[model samples]
Target: MPYTLIKSSNPEDFVLVHRFLMQAIQRLRAAGIPLWEPEDVSVDALVKAYGTHSLYLVMDNEKTIGGVFVLEEDALFWPEIVTNDSFFFHKLVIGDDFITKGIGHRVLDALVELAKSHGKHWLRCDCHGDRPRLRNFYESFGFYFIDRKTVEGFDAARYEYPCL
Candidate 1:
């Protein structure tokens, strides 16, 4: 299947993004993953994401199958890392039906190119530290495990990919 990557800005696309995230949230909770709280899935958070970050959505035809945020400044969650030199990514959510289909990997590959085009040296992100599966997934993409720390009440494992 052919997938298109789009920068979500219009109200309809924003609504799709919110719905996609809510579906991911439900799937995560059902799988016993404490990756996000109820507050994180709200439309308010979606609006905040739109205001603060560059939101990209992967679409198969008209449906949004996945999305992620490319944030320039992330001192709130990753205070230790200098934000000036790196591109930060968050909420790489893939719809439940689209899991294990290499869509996330493709999205990430595009993100790496996005970082490179912007002259960023590193691509960084954080995930629930205790989820080995999630950690390994990042490692599989050539992202090195940097460190683990508690951020905003969650134990997060940081990963960085050198975009050289």
Candidate 2:
């Protein structure tokens, strides 16, 4: 089945989306891969994202299974050249129960199309440089590795997909 992408700004969907994120965080922590900080997965932070960014929930049938945050500008990480032409996506997490189900590719493809429709030249994202599996996953999805850098004590690997 195809995945559904819902922007998490509606009050009716906020609770369900928040619960999905919480579940994803718990699973990630249990797997010993500490990607998100505790506060990053909190309901308050997610709600804040809804206000400042485009937060999306990936739904399988009628169930929420994953989410991501997208924005046009991210001065905190991307250099000026990239930030000027890219739609940046962050906090992309697929729920543990849905792993290996190919949901990520569908969601990412949709995001790329969204970027293209918005006239963006690139779809960009960042991940912890320490996680090879995560990096490989992005690479497998055709994201070109741009660079790896440490910012504010966090090591990150930047990737970009040309939205052509």
Candidate 3:
């Protein structure tokens, strides 16, 4: 399946993205995956992030299947790496209907390409430290486990993929 990631500045897109995130949060909670909280994702917060981050809507041809945010710098999660040599991925939410269809893997591949196009050396992201399945998912995508850290009251497992 071909996925198109469009950098959207539209307010409607923000709402759609927020909806997708909240849906994923609910699914995760039901599955006992303590990842994202409702407060962690809101339309207002996403709107604020739009000014500083690249918010993308993942499209599967005509349908919007997911969304993600790309940040040039993520000092809060990765304070030790004080450099813009990487693209930080956040809020990668795929619709429930699209899960397990290899859409997430394809999205990661697209993100890695996007990072390489921007001359970034690596693509980085963090997930709940205790989610082994999620961590394994990233690891399966060629992302190496960096370290686990408690940042801003969230315990996160950082991972980085070489954009070579």
In terms of TM-score, which candidate is strongest?
3
Identify the candidate with maximal lDDT: 3
lDDT (C-alpha) at residue 7 in model 2: 72
What 10-residue stretch in candidate 2 is worst by lDDT?
9-18
Comparing 2 with 3 on lDDT, the higher-scoring candidate is 3
Q: How do all the candidates rank in terms of TM-score, highest first? A: 3, 1, 2
Model 1, stretches more than 4 Å misplaced? Answer: 1-4, 49-53, 61-63
Estimate, for each residue in 1-164, the C-alpha lDDT of model 2 and write its tens digit: 56767777666455555666677768778899876666765767766754534777787787777777788887777766644677888877777677775777888888887788888999999899999988998999999999999977889999999997
Error of 1 at 151 (Å): 1.0
- Model 2, position 39: C-alpha lDDT score: 78
Measured over all alpha carbons after superposition, the RMSD of each candidate to the real structure, in angstroms, is: 2.2, 2.3, 1.6
Q: Kindly indicate the candidate among 1 and 3 with the higher TM-score.
A: 3
lDDT of each: 0.78, 0.78, 0.85
What is the Cα-based lDDT of residue 102 in candidate 3?
Answer: 75
Screening candidate 3 with a backbone cut-off below 3 angstroms (N, C-alpha, C), the clashing residue pairs are: none
Task: Evaluate candidate 3 by giving its C-alpha RMSD to the native, one decimal.
Answer: 1.6
